[model samples]
Target: MVQSQTHTFEGKTIDEAIEEAKRALNAEMDEIDIRVIDHGNQKRFPFGRSRAKIAVSLTESNDETWETWLDNEIEDQDLFDIPLSPDEKQPVNTAGTAWIIDGQLHFHQTAEKKPILVIPYDGEVYNHNEKLSGRHVLKENDVIDFHLETTLIETKWTVKVNDKEQTVTLTVTPGKKIIPYIADHPAASVIEPIVQFDEQVNNQLQTKDVYEQLANMEVIEGIDDAAIHRACSAGEEQTVTIASGKLPKDGKNGEMAFRIDIQERSLPYKEKHDGTADFRESLYIPSVEHGEVLAEVIDPLPGEDGISVFGDVLQAKDGKPVIIKAGSGIEIDEEQSAVIAAQSGRPLIEQSGLLFRMSILPKKRHPGDLSIKHGNIRFIGDVEITGDVNEGMTVEAEGNVQMQKNVMHSTIQSRQNILIHGNAIVSAITAGQNQAVYDALQDIVPISSPRTDLLSP
Candidate 1:
């Protein structure tokens, strides 16, 4: 058994220490485990300075395995009975308050060192015989004289209007309730001792206060009373939608309607019970007869106007029109509002911005042989192959397919009739897109040589 080796290294930084360790041990980073011992501090000038230290230990031999190392290093512990510090250990920092209510003054202290409550400029308070001036702190059993204010802490609210003046939101800052003393007190008294008086937070806001604020802001069009009432009931610090503006609906753009069956031709493969689907079935090219309607042009619709909570008028949008023009092999019927095919050929559509250009190509002709270098051939119009169709090449046409030479190890299919004046050897060919004809053709023996008279069809 080879024993593990351990060493210590120090440098200005952790990366420098690891690099020094790696150079000294002549080992890569993954071959050993690194443990940081002390992260040294570097102070200004020469006052305090220390180097970073790391302990690099060689990993256990490959034979020991990770499970064995884990079993040797880790031990089970009793974690259920862990003890916690007592709550009395926590420090306390609390202050006291004082207030006056119901023609009487009171003061209460919560800690050893109580704060002195000073009389503000708006307060009408007096210290018995001599009227108190400036700041005055009342003590226990001290005599004080003051006028009886009817409502000490009244409900306060405010209204916020959006920048666009489209919405008005109401925010209510709840007031505190003046809790009168529980002890016996004389009514309309001249002097009362500062003994018992307290106050509690009152979250309930008044609706009348909100309405007065809204009226001041001139927001009366789309005010929601229920939302304001709910806000008043909840009373916490929150913003609610008191008024909302009606949003404008944009107009629908003009569209073109084409034949549904032609668009639905190219579909995804359907999975069979055997868990296999043929990709060729998903490929289809649609063809139209002469004078067949291709697309119907529809006009654009206009948009509606909207109104804001501030009674401002919002303008409506007018829908734009789509322009259409006919190219070769296509014609537009103005009376029927449709685009018709002029000849029995493939229909081609090209779109640029809002303009749609429709045309049709008569046929697609190949001057050379169909091979791997030329790739597969798929066209919407009839195909005319002048040369041979090579191995692994496929030809698919929407209309008729006419081959002049030989077809070897290839697939040729067409939606219409197929005329091949070539020798087909180990190749699949279908005429009129009939499944039964393709199946019967697959069973026929492959012809090796050119049999012009026997194979030509």
Candidate 2:
């Protein structure tokens, strides 16, 4: 959208001078995007030989954009548009007659014989007096003068000299008021002067509350509670504190709005240390928390190792083995055999073998197998399936549980071991550890198993 602007310059015509101003303003059009729309005649000397001095107001695309555009225009012209021409010749009628010392009539007086009338001259005002008065009697020194005056008749109509129509009042008598005229002209207002005290007061007020808070609060090594509180209260202005040096005023919402210079603290030790016997530095250290260590060994000894080991054993907790170790050629009495046989009841396994045992049975008896029907499911622990698990079902067990049939769209988890007996089909299966449980089911199949039943005729 094109914007309007007023540019004033003295030239022979309004258009010529206005075009010159526009050219000067548009010289740097590539730098600042400014487009002039139209020019307005602010104060025009229509009947003047004074080079038609005018305040040409024109419109631009944007007002703010015009400032830089005007700057560029001034730089390009190397001068303001203020005209440097001689004074203009006023209109004949409105141009007052010279004094009698110069033998001029006091036409400004209402009683002059041939008065040169000035009826608030705005532009060229013409007078039409068709009925002319014949030559009047005059002496060698008769004052032949005229004065421009306005007379109100019956408070209804007004008569003003120098207007084109001599009989009645014309609508164009008040061509344009001078107040608005001057306002529209270029350089109408002076540039404002800067007040340094006002700027300083504003800066002080901006940081007054923050400084007050900083002064009131306790000072600590790493915590600036007062500064933080002040910053929080300040909302948008915040301050930051350095660890071992003065607090920096560069933080957001605390103190300074932008960046501020701050000296960083030196390192604990200097690069080149002076050889002094009494030289010592106190360093601030943070407290560290102690944590348990977890280490893994291939063949661990009994007393010498942190974790005890047993063959065919899984874990030991509280000085008791969850799974017993069985070695080759080791004979067991009747009582020991019964105990061992009773412990080897069922093995619980996990879905992913990385977690729990895989392909091994547990020595202790466990709860019976649990089965689920169709639906999407997730299990937290191990699960045992006695019968066929339908599609889209999940089974979870804390301990190992065996399955009889194939599971579909489900998961099984176990802490110990998992054993499968019958054929498992049409499902996803996961195991925990490498040898946590045993899978005796020979017909175990993945979801990608071949569809032999579909191919049959």
Candidate 3:
């Protein structure tokens, strides 16, 4: 038979003794279930020791499993719902604020207060919905009435209850209405009319009434001398004083009723003539020897009336008066004057043909000696090499390639034609393979493949 394990500790009260037993068993309050089997008589106990008997029920298991279960129970008991005061608990208002005609809702809140509202309407409403069904203009004495329903939730315990939802209905009747005046069918001011007039003096000269009477008038009878004299006498008195140079003062005496006729005068004609001179075969006559002859004709030939002569004067074959030079030469007639001029040298005439020929070739120096290298060299024109090149060098030219030395492990390409005048070794030739080469050669003479040999050792 197994002996029952009984443990007891004395304290002033049952709670104190049960705490002592819990400490002895190394069990927390949540891990064990305590049952009081006997509350010992307080009379029989001593002054400081009150007798209490109890049994603690706990799971019998390994220390690790027991500790794990005890830790989970402690953690679950630690969480609790904190209580809120009456002032801190309030309701959320769901009805939105009011709005004026052609106006929007504006909200103002203090630091301790929050304004949140929800609106219920007849249609499906989404966030940021705008309503434009009301009248834009408000008239005087107009009433705008709306109802606001605010829901408030007041709690009795820490746990929230849905049945305690309360609503407060608010009816807002806006104050005295003032209507804004909007202009409709506005009137525009009329522009003033402008008047114009034309007159010779202060009186209107071209009057319609006077023109109508003159339109019917005809030249039926000529004016008499007495009538003309009478009309001239009635006019303003005027005196005519003629200038001495403008009018002829030495006119015939007793001449009356003078008449003047004006005519345009014609100008005198002037003619210019260019004298012809030939110096192709004329011998050089010094200026000192022919000083007088030069001086007489130095003014250059005048208008079309003058004539010029050059070179030796000889008779024509027909025996007419003539002059002859090495080339065709002629003289003027006896009525006109002819001038003979002498020149010192023959005139120069420019020849009209090609002047010079030139040829261009690739530079024939090493890259180290020159500013540029000839690796994968391409020429727009002919390529003539006068120096040596290292192995794995390439040359592409449009016209021809005339190399004085050997080209090894290189390439040569041309579009128009190619002529190599040196030995080539281990080189590849790719030309006229595709339409791309022909297309690239339209403006640029030749398109050459890249020289992979340049990267070779």
Candidate 4:
């Protein structure tokens, strides 16, 4: 006889625990037998903070059988699969036993310690000064006393399951107390339990009661019985959207429609290559040509009505209308659906009027480098500069910027690439694409570091 190795491990799930055991023991499926101690459950999604346990031990595959298999005499019948895992979660809730939680009352007794007490939520009892089983609500100045002692204790459970039945018993030591019906708790199947678990769970829900809360309740065909059964078995407290009143679905609001290809200029950060974060593409000035339709205001949609759970009719609010009429070089379409371009210019859409309006402005020009003479140029069209953009100058253009001289120590923004004949030095230049900008500064070295920030690069 050979002594077999044994070990126990825990994981977020049973499969995980088994895999951990396999890794620790370095054994194959045929070489080990796994006994699941506890099939743990999660309280919610993505991940629930709970654990499961499993026991693993080397199988009793004797030496003689192994020798026969090693001689190439093994057949497909030699392999087998084992299945002993829970299909879904089955929690054992402890909510019903408390009846009431986190409440206090005035005690008339002079004793220094008060016994742990639990009472029903709806039921009532007489409130006497000495009795702990009364129905009186507690408030401030309530007489209470207790000697605090913190002791760590282990919880134990014994589970027995069969094709038709599943039973769970919780045991507490030091006090030697055992409570059966772990599957019978009111909160057991908080999510959904399999139909096989129906016989095991206690405190099942009543569907008729839940249906009463919803107005114009429609019977969800096919899976209704199974869903309700599973929900009841799980003892879930979360509001069942299927069985509740449905609120109105508000209509889609009217919007100024535009294409993403034309509006993807202002980037949050520059993408990285090897290890550097390029910040070049922060400047986005949306521009439009003389004959281009920069924006179109779509029509508002009507809302859909909803029914309350209590059979009340809920009103649906309609989407508000927006007006895009005001602006030079831009005019409303014949159908009044869109704001069309009258002449070439950049459209400035804003919500200044009761609804919304867009204004189009003409081209801009900076005679010399940006200075106090220019005073922060913010143009909605193409821009041209005759001289270098000197220190502390800020220029923003909705269209392309054509610079004749080097840009230095300033903020230059453009929706399209800013074509510069001279070097770009010590300035934050934001543009749609930086590849052209990189090519423009291919040989230009920094005159001084000057804390320059090149965005949307």
Candidate 5:
């Protein structure tokens, strides 16, 4: 039996009319054969509606009375192509995006450009399947319906189901099809089905429902869905940090890290005769010996590593090394990291870059008393005191000390011998007490001449 179906359409030309029928019937050029029945006249005056008629029928029989079924299909297609009434035969579908109309959330890099949607499906984020050119808002679990105009793609497929052949209509979409495909109407853009890349979501992305953008084949390619899933699960500023390069730390000049304790050891001001406190004088004199270590350098630290958001590695600046120059009567030991005195003398660190050395004081005769006028003495070499050491004063020497007058109510310390021609008197101060008594006298005599260490001036 021959199976055939007929339909008609009006356009500016016969081809345009036929093309409209093809779209209405949803048929490709090769799928059906057409015989022109009539070419309707155009308006002899101005632009008037043109009309035409054609008979369409299948060409071959792929299966057998499926041929009759094909005839029935043709008749069904012809009925579907015609509207419910003749006046409404021509139906128009305006092309654009469909899903954006009912969307709950929307996003874009800039506020002016078209925004992508983050749709929630089964507790995860997805993008708009439609290639949205403008703004659209979508929310989680919003029921979206893809109309035929928005979702239909030009595609055809067949599958062997139950060991028998069955025609399966395919829509152009992103999914697990594993086949070459285009849409039912390939030119008509489609809204993608939302996809969930992660179970958890990032806070920044979550606030905007942007866990994942529905991947569209036309706009974007090679989307790492798994990577997007991992990013979403990271849930915040958990993205990779760019590696920061290390800077070279400038070397610090070596110096003594230890404190020169002067406050605790210095003498406090006290009252003199008439039980009145002078409240004026306090003294300190620091002394040192030969081969003594005064200062050391600290260990250098290593540089830290840096990283980038894209997972690139960066280097950090390392701490630089420092060297301390030892001056006269001083030695530098690299292994010990120390500046040591070569000989016994007053420990002196010079003004030049924290270098350490020793200084030997010179013997001098003074006309006046060794009181506040001379201040406190810190001599590294042999010292001579011609006048009496007045009350509340300190004289420290690394070498032997020789005095012409007695030391009264003063302190005198020497690394070597002490020679005093007169008495070395010591005194005590008692708070709220009546009397001021002198302690034992200190006197020293040397057995041999001493060696002196001095820095060259």
Candidate 6:
């Protein structure tokens, strides 16, 4: 037979056109030269349908002699016109795929360009009682079957019911399905086989299978069917919750929010522009005017009950009530649920367990030396010491601290200002007590040197 040196073919896609060329030339992929004339447009179809076209020719290295062509009378035949024997046809390694969309079969690939799949030719696959073959989109409820056979894929999973019996979860390691096909042989590529994968469970799990698992675990309440379906079809390793239970919400505790510095009763220091402590700047003293509101009371709330998947009721705790008492220069406003100052001085709070007392003092005077007889003086108002403070004596005041005589081997702390008219000998005196305490804390951890771990036991 005398065949043309080159020929052109058209198909739905470039791969299909090449497959046709290979069969016409009776040659392998390497034995031919192919030029893509046109890549078919799947879109803009019907009115402007474009089919993929390719030009194929045998390579110069082809030197095969046709055994029966010389004896035949056929001559000058086109490449496609030449008749092909069963043995002469080459294998075509292409196949079509199918998917279920909106409860209907879709023969073509999805928009995501997933691989085209072909259902294996089996008696099980049917479209309304008729055996199906090739690519065909069927209506809903149409069964799609194919033999999935493989041994290399691995799948493992575990179903866990939470200790509270409030949830059910599945931890799965999905497996893969490998479907083999032959290219040139048109028959094998068309009829895809369907078989069950040899594993603990197939990666392609059904929603019903998951529903059965949840039923076995006795998770009847709040069973999320959608979540179970998504997990079954994910075909990847993941932990998914198939059921859930409501949780109990605890009540809020009662609280008292102070608007002023009644807890610490300290003065705040000023900082320089360069972020350094400016000791020259006077610290701001925290004091309340008469009738100023000190704190607001927050009411407690009752908690809500919850239910478990096993139909068990979970009880919740109620919040506790808060109380506030007025001390010297302070009054409680029951109508506003607030603590108000009766006289202006310095606000203070004394706590004994859950009970709280709010107070304010104007000043405290000392007649003589601060010795063992006088004991240590701790006042929220200004303090005036007439005589010297002996060794081991301590004096702390939220307002100004004035010393008339010498202080020796003693400690004096004032939140606002410290005025010493007499000499302070071997004494530790702090004007801004809060700032001094903060500075002392910083010195405890030296960043520039190897330091010991104070927290280590």
**Cα-based TM-score, every candidate:** 0.46, 0.16, 0.16, 0.31, 0.31, 0.42
TM-score of 4: 0.31
Give the alpha-carbon lDDT of every model: 0.64, 0.30, 0.31, 0.49, 0.43, 0.61
| Residue 403 displacement in candidate 5 (angstroms) | 8.1
Candidate 4 per-residue lDDT over residues 35-80, each given as its tens digit: 8899997786747567889988987645454444533321344221
Instruction: List residue ranges in candidate 6 displaced over 4 A.
Output: 1-66, 69-156, 163-166, 175-201, 263-281, 323-330, 342-344, 350-357, 364-382, 385-403, 406-457
Who wins the lDDT comparison?
A: 1
Backbone clashes in model 3, listed as residue pairs? 94-118, 271-303, 272-303, 272-304, 273-303, 273-304
Off by over 4 Å in 3: 1-372, 430-436, 440-457
Candidate 1: deviation at residue 148, Å? 14
Model 4 per-residue lDDT at 95: 23
Off by over 4 Å in 5: 1-256, 259-281, 310-312, 350-457
On residues 1-457, what C-alpha lDDT tens digit does candidate 5 reach at each position? 3545666566656687778777887887866677787686767765664567666664443444543554466377642221234565543221222222222221112112222333223222323443332323533333333322122222221111111111111111111212211122211123333422222221222211221222111112223345444443442333321112223234433334422221113456667798875543344333334565544556666666544222334455655554454555667678987656576443444344333333322343345578874466654455677878889876655456777878888777665667778887883212111122111111111112222222232
TM-score between candidate 2 and the true structure: 0.16
| 308: Cα error in model 5, Å | 3.3
Candidate maximizing TM-score: 1
Candidate 2 lDDT over 175-227, as tens digits, reads: 11111111111121111111111111011122344334323432222333454
Tens digits of per-residue lDDT, candidate 6, 20-83, equal 9888778889778888999988665586879999988877531123313421322333211223
Q: What is the lDDT of residue 174 in candidate 5?
A: 17
Q: Which 10-residue span in candidate 2 carries the lowest summed lDDT?
A: 285-294
Residue pairs with colliding backbones in model 1 are: none
Assess candidate 2 and give its lDDT.
Answer: 0.30
TM-score of 5: 0.31
**Which 10-residue window of candidate 1 scores lowest in summed lDDT?**
448-457
The per-prediction CA RMSD against the true structure, in angstroms, equals 35.5, 35.9, 46.3, 36.1, 23.0, 24.8
Q: Rank the candidates by lDDT, best first.
A: 1, 6, 4, 5, 3, 2
